[model samples]
Target: MQFSKSLMLLATLATGTFAHPAVGRRQATATSAAVSSDWTATPSSGAYSTAGFGSSTSSSGTGVTYEGNVGNPYGSNIIQISSSDASQYKYVAQFTGANTDSWTVAIFNKYGSDGKMDGWYGQACLTFTLAAGETKYVAFDDDSQGGWAAASGSTIPTDSNGGYASTWGEFDFGSTTNNGWSGFDVSAIAAQNADMTVSGMEICDALGGTCSSISPDAATVNNAYTSAETDVGGIGGNIASGPVRLAVTIDYSG
Candidate 1:
């Protein structure tokens, strides 16, 4: 289902403004750490693999595109990671030719027993067009949280759509009570034969401190995304159902 820009526009009228989610107040002090790495590959029939992670199937869509037949098609299309270690890094995944229907960019995290997202971090989503052989970069930030919150007035459709427009929004994974997370969940159902290819993926440590970057410690991305998806909702929207590929990225601070 296409996003109701009118609805979004109406909501905008309330405050007449759109904004990014607010971050936690506690400013864990630190310096800027660089996280420049790549993990780009086509899934082997719905299976995702990284340097140190397990394999999971997509149920429907493999690699980039999918028929979106099965129920909950976007169940497990992420690189899993284990725990948080000192060497934790950043991760990112880009998509090219994504000028079709709707698309989503999300980051999922599995919290450890300690009540915090063990190795979890943050994620981002962007919309762009390709220029005959040109590619675009869609990245995620593992250094922060609060990207999964829903954008104001925007409702997730339970069906499908043919196109989507560009708009700034936010998402909230349930509430603060739930250890859910925050990340981008972009939906673009615009039908325009375009080729979207994810160029790279990386993971790193947090920016302000030595805290967990992508995850709390050394956790891999595969595990991180899976853990988070367990509670993720409104995936591909109401109209568009089943099997969607969510382009993602991992940020590391080494």
Candidate 2:
């Protein structure tokens, strides 16, 4: 993704020849915050692959690469924070492909009584088309609710309450049509919480045909923050026959 180019475009779109101080000032604040932070790639849950760019995986965990065969359902555990105190973090989901297919990504946040992993909340949903060999990055902050952006180092726009919960978050990828082969190259998470000990991380899979039945892997990621290149979709090049709900369980502590 062309971070500088996209920022220029965003500026041009936000303001014309005449600049509004109020709007410009707000934009400037957001831009500055995003630019100030350095992003670290999260480790992969499975085996690591260098076929894609933007993120890397570690040796201990495995990575899944979702490519080829359209209309299949794929999901990944994007962020999993298990801290006693409130923590702030950001998740980056990068999609890279060489096709002109439209894809839909649904973000699910685990919620319930005391952040128990009892229910799942649909936080944000996004759909976009990718040109051949195009790489696009979407980011969301746990503290800011459902803010998302296309450029890396770009501040998340605060529109909805996407605040972080004491649970797991996931990204579900699928095609809008049966066109075939949408790519999800990277699944990365970055924690900005200060003085927080890195406990564990792992790749999880949500299976079944309904939202309530979806489950996650019991393992945790061994590293602090890392990226994964895992293939999270249906088997035999076919999409799941029924409603494949992507949900997570939250277990918050007091």
Candidate 3:
């Protein structure tokens, strides 16, 4: 379905980031049921599925678990930390002598007219401060209803659309404060009929813009963040330290 003029305007105003004026139109990829999720770390040992982060070290931990199917073209990319375990695994601290003390975790999807992953169609960045031995949970999701943790003292910020809803099937990590963090819910925008290409996830400074393009044909296991770029969103207020870690999971039906 074509986006209404009002909806497009709302997106332009809400993000303050406009879509590339020259985006080419292309056919959407075929829907698939083959789903998969992967996890990665900067130092290789900072995250664990069980305890999360490092088991021996005192640094904070970060991880991504998948829920839902990408085979459903109109379905939502539901990747988030559980609200039930929000208190146990939301915000995390950086290990001493690690890259940076802060982090910006995000999920990115590419859209192009070439029927391939082109430029970023929708992206969400969750920025947080991490101190040694401190664990905090920050919730985020691609759903329109906002899949964040409200009881965790976090809430999604109101956008130009009035509430925390995704217009162009976008994703969000809520606001950059504790109060904002408490308002997270599992609401995502439906894919509708938009054509999109799934790009792998990445961890970088909280600054906006593109970081690196992960090859979708790689091993599909645990790929490290590489070919980093510094000029993502042009020095933003939400900046993170160096050496950000990101874990990504992609579920698609072949």
Candidate 4:
């Protein structure tokens, strides 16, 4: 379990780019706020701490590592935020087919504006299975931006630099403190760069602002990032500030 996540990539270390997931937007608050509590630890065992990144407390109530954690920080995936607290956050769900297969998924919190674009928090990964018509919703703090990396195997592949090697479901939420604009996109640059299997993925705001997706073959893409689109920026959605509920479809086919 190598804990170093300083990803050195070919894309710009700052600003917006499809090659990496940047230029994040975050929600209704005047400024981005740190979330605290509401998460319950799972049954698995690992060194789980209750810490949050960037002046924010872990909304899930515990800090986690990418691979060594006992289980998902969000626990049951049915979050425990109070109605009052829920007002300040948006939710996203990962949908899958009706099969009982499992996948490795990890969500990393971006280190704000420190460069080293892959500013991943200590660790944030969730591995689970979804039955028919089942999905799990994960909450995102207002004015927060990060990436959710998913792969089809029990173990997620890593890049040459040991970073997650998979298509990223990048998201940015709006708040009063920030620009108050939300955005989401998909990036396959990591997987392609590692020459690994690129899983298909799609992300769309539940309210239908816009969508970003890529096919499994890595040929057909819509508003999503591909290795060929390394130099591109601002390819994903730029939604107005409000309550955002993004739906991310993994192992996408269409």
Order of candidate numbers by lDDT, starting with the best? 4, 1, 2, 3
Relative to the true structure, how large is the alpha-carbon lDDT of every model?
0.23, 0.22, 0.22, 0.50
**lDDT comparing candidate 4 with the true structure:** 0.50
Q: Which candidate comes out best when scored by TM-score?
A: 4
lDDT of 1 by residue, 1-254 (tens): 12222111111112212222233212121122311122232222422122322122111221111111111122121233322211121233233222222233333323211323221122222223233223333222221212221111222111122112121122221111111122223321211111211111222112211111122122332212222232334331111111112332221212
- The superposed Cα distance between candidate 3 and the true structure at residue 193, in angstroms, equals 32
Better of 2 and 3 by lDDT: 2
Per-residue lDDT of model 4, residues 132-179, tens digit only = 345555655443445667776566688776777887777655422223
Q: What is candidate 3's lDDT per residue for 1-254, written digit by digit as tens?
A: 22222111122122322122111211122122211121112213322122221111111111111111111122122234432333222222111112223322222322222222221232232323333223343322211111211111122223342322221222222221111111110111211122222222222322233222122322231212111211112211122222222221111011
Give stretches of model 2 more than 4 Å off.
Answer: 1-90, 112-125, 142-254
Residue 181 lDDT (model 3): 18
lDDT of 3: 0.22
lDDT of 1: 0.23
Report the lDDT tens digits of candidate 2 across residue range 184-216. 111122111211122112222223222211111
Best by lDDT: 4
Worst 10 residues of 1 by lDDT: 63-72
Candidate 4 Cα errors over 4 Å, as ranges: 1-89, 97-100, 112-117, 120-122, 125-133, 175-178
lDDT (Cα, 0-100) at 252 in candidate 4: 78
What is the TM-score of candidate 2?
Answer: 0.22
